[model samples]
Target chain A: MKKILSLGLLCTTILLSQAQAASTPTVSGVFEKTVHAFAENHAPLGQIPASDLLNQPVAGIDEETGFLKVQTPKGLVLVARAAVTTTMTAAAPRETSCSYIGTLAASGTGSSSGFASNCKAGAR
Target chain B: MMVMFWIVYKFFDPLSLESATKNSSAQFFSAITAPFYGLSSPRSHQRVAVVTINDPTLQQFDAALPLSYQRQVFILRQILEADPAAVFVDFRMAYEHTDESLSLFQSVLDEAKSKHIPIFFARGEEGQDQIHLLPPLRNVESYSNALETSSAYPLLFEEGNAALKEDEPSQEETRKPEANAAFDVYRSLCTSTWSGQCGSFHEDDFRRPMMIQWGLHVDPAQTQVSSLANSPRNICAVPFSGGFFCRSIVQSFTLGFRAFWGSSRDYEVGHAYYPLTIGAHQLGERGLGTPAGSPPLSHLLKGRAVFYGTDIRDQHDDTVLPFLGRVPNVVLHAMAFDNLVTYGNHYFHEPSEVEFGHGVHIGQAEICEFILWLIFTGWMAFKFYYSHPEVPRGHGAKLRHDIRRKSRDFLSLSLSVNALVPAIFCAALAAFDLSHQPTLLNGMDEALLYVCLFLVLLGTLVLLRRSAQRSQPEEAEHAHGPEESEAEKAEKFRLGFWAHLALLTSLTAIVFALNELFIQWPNADWIGFILLWLAVGESCESTGFVLTFVNFLNRRSHALTSERVPNSESSSQ
Candidate 1:
């Protein structure tokens, strides 16, 4: 009974860890406006939804492609280097209100979405 | 003989032979206007500025096509803000457009109109004589008051028309009806948005078609363009006046463009032009900030007459000029405009009667001067041969010797005179060309005429010498008798020939050097100057020849006398 409980506990820990890995890390800091967003072919995709981008987690940038990886409700979005206009600001954690005003395009290959914004990052 | 020669020369059109020869008379004109190497008339400097829509500027837009209407509006706004003297947009704007783009474009046009800035748009013909603005823009008449159409037509007659009788009024009348009827046919054939005439516009509900004006005028102070107004219509209209007979004349679009923008300099007595050029990329760089490394557009464009057109390599706007092979159409327009405003069209007389007369009078003066030259040269040749005939030298041996010596002198004199004629003529022509005033004849024609005269003189001299020789058998035999051997006689002839040839060559060199030096002297009579030099050269050559011959004779006599004295003294001893 002790061995079975220990095995169950191990399985539960692994599953929890997997679940944690699947859930994206919450990105803090102010959201900035976007400048331009485009697909791989450079076709302009209009404005991306503010709610979709506000609390989305950044999944690190791809070094080779220079794309910004962001986790959204839909899927993992890759913003091309050319499309990305906004830089992330690391600030003291506070209620930040941001507004974006640039282009957004779907990321083609591995990423499910892409966006380029130049939003105002400020403490509300 | 002179009359006959003149008749043959004038009527047979010997000057026209210049076309067949490799060294054509046209080459002389070509050299003067040669773009790279030829003399640049002060007028060649940029007078009008051309803004070209180049490849890089096109690339800045999406899909690298012609500028979208929005971009055009932006560009137009920037240009209008710069406040040029006039703006000529050499693009068609007669097409269906998006409502938004049309409204935007209309607003820009309105702004330009309100500014009182003369903005001219290019008018083009659609399929089967249909007149329309170039595709995608509409409601042109609502926005702009004036439209620009091309006056460019075939200036030269085709082969079929060459056989038509010049004086046949019936044929001319027939041609007139055909010509007059064609414009209506053309109007019917073509469809247009303006609902007015293809080449005309409505002025206060009265439709007036465009006229072919003789010249245009731009006020230097106000920069206002005006056509030759109130001129008699159909006065200079030939059957080939591009099918527009008795039409009220107005300045061509290019001419009007030039009057406003062309840069001019007072070169000597007349004006010379330098066409201004600007690139579209530079304009875009200044306004939109796309392409890098362009000059600030404002500095070049402000208070300038700006012309905008497409100059892409494969866009087919290239034209061939006299020496400047294929150049962009805008450049051609600039050149033509410069030619009209600065030089005025000497060939066509739309400018004024006085201006046309001035050109004709200059031509007449040149013809008169050529005739005088021919007469004087002919008289000089006649006098030269007749005035200095050898006097009879008493009897037998002495007379024969004198005749032989005179013949040798005549040969040298003839050679020098013949060579001098052409050398002087060439020098005179070069000097005339370089003068501030226009040249009457080109260098090659002058050279050809002089060379022909020299050949005639040479032939006459040869015939005269042969006849004189034929008549003097006794003198010839005595002259060739035992005093000189055949080989020695042959040697003397060879030496005389070489000496004559050397003199000719030296004279040619001297004349060339003089030509270069005297090329810039104003109002100098080159003909009289050359004649004076020729006379001086002939006198000097004759004096030098006489002195040398006398010295040679004295040496020979002294040697013979000394040898004879020694032989006698030895015999007596």
Candidate 2:
């Protein structure tokens, strides 16, 4: 039981860490540059809040994946992602269904080009 | 630094329903209006015809004699006596009577011609193919003598569409869904009768959404429903204009019922049309007749008509109307009889009905979709966080088999171009809709938002997916086990942090280009170049980030699986 619990805790820690990295607001000295970039392109209401989770906090953590949870006070239900980068796309709305996404990555870092397509938000 | 590579890989995650529905808002219109399938509009005509008085005066003891016989005779007599523009006796003569009144009804048709009344007989639509119009039993009259006998079709709904042009008299085309038609059939039926009510049916937004779909307006609020014994059980003759009423064949119902119960009969309700209660009774005890005795038949018949036919053993349409299958023909006549007294047929819809059917989509589809997306994303993150790493399940892989048995079909199943299914579908839909909308600069700029979102979601998810597919031996630099050396954990974090930075830079560049080049800002050239440089930097950094994350997850999963089977497999979800 202790082993199982620790394993669970470790996994949770890794996941939370990744989520936090993902959503961590940039602290800058480089802040002016990041804000300038955001202000230059952002459209009003044109931006859809996209996420692998409902509330993304730790974003750039490796070994982090998906989860299912419901928000209280307002019963906003989130589906359990139950997946990692490699296994996420296996679901399609069956019991463990993920969203109707095509794949886990469209243009992540593996491209042979100089820049990542879009999935490199944490690699800045 | 290792985190840099992982961040770039996270940009490739698949989308969720919450995201898809939010992004695709235009389809909601069609989905919202799909349920107006029931409101049919029978063309109302301008012809005044015969009236069959269904006064209780004719019943033997006011005890409603198996009204199967006298009803036809009474209808025939009225046709003969009214010698009006035309005569329509809505009695179903096809019915079987112990003392057959078939000849008597036929004799009355003969009398109508002999008396010089332009006469017509009606049949329910489903029965039209079979109804043979007999030359009036005594076709010895002339048109100059006011005696042209005619055949009429019984239908339902008035104020539906412009009358079918003479060239297109067939009813098939008229039977399509017409929510966009000129006069709202449901609305006209409700407001035309001088009834006290105003707005047509609408479900309450707070409580109910599915609107009650009954064609006519019967207020459960106003009328005191009689005792179940005395509940108004009557067949109704709804005002279906084109000089006839829709006749429902009860024999069809009985035949169908018997078929289900191992008893077959020849009964059919060929296209029965029901009424829209406009709150006024035109031919009732308190019907359209004025105090001075003039029949309010003009206003009543303005949008109304009449119908009559043979109620036979095996001739019913038995159509399961959209919401509910209904009264057999016999019961329908009885119901129509009851329509004469206590309550008026006014058009109204309960609040609950409309909301379920139409309002919710109009009111909440977007918000619901967005919220659903957020919840789904959060859950995914949570699941991944909680489900991995063994924490040294004290017991070892020795308790379970090391080589996890995989279905032979797994590789063949997902690899057969099926893996390309989503991308292909997405490309098709994206290209298809984009082609239709005029491409605007602003819209191009908006692509930046999508890029940013997809990058963040994809980078992390892609790493997870790849690691899940590969074995651990080749997965170096991964923090594989709960007791993984701190060196591995540090390596994982270092890899992840850099990947995130690399991705953030690339996205910021693309967005900059999008805003400048696509959105056509004055500084577009400079912004685009800056974005282009950032994109290059991020891309280079992204490769390393993705490789590291994927490698780590792959090694971890393989190590865990090799160490324990059921624990890893079952706990994966």
lDDT by candidate, in order shown: 0.36, 0.28
| Each model's fraction of native contacts | 0.00, 0.00
Q: Which TM-score values does chain B get in all models?
A: 0.38, 0.26
Worst 10 residues of 1 chain A by lDDT: A99-108
Candidate 2 wrong stretches, greater than 4 Å: A1-124, B1-63, B66-73, B76-92, B95-214, B218-290, B296-299, B308-568, B571-573
Alpha-carbon TM-score of each model against the true structure: 0.35, 0.23
* lDDT digits (tens) for residues B1-573 of candidate 2: 123322232223234322232212212211111111121211211222212222212211121323434444543453344333334333333344554434555666667557544344332223123232233422221110000011011122222432333554465365432111011222223334312332333312111111212222221111111111111111221222112111111222233243334321112211122221211111212221123333322223232222232222223411122112322232232222222111122211111112555444222322332344345334432323322354343333322222222322233344433335434433443344345333322233233333433444355334433433443333443435345432332233222444545444444434433332233221211222222233333222224443344445656566665474334332222
Q: What RMSD does each model have against the real structure?
A: 23.8, 39.5
True contacts kept of 2: 0.00
**TM-score, model 2 to reference:** 0.23
lDDT for each residue of candidate 1 in A1-124, tens digit (9 for 90 to 100): 9999999999999999878765644443221233223334435555455355555666766665445566667666655422222335432222111111111011111111001112234311
Candidate 1 has what TM-score?
0.35
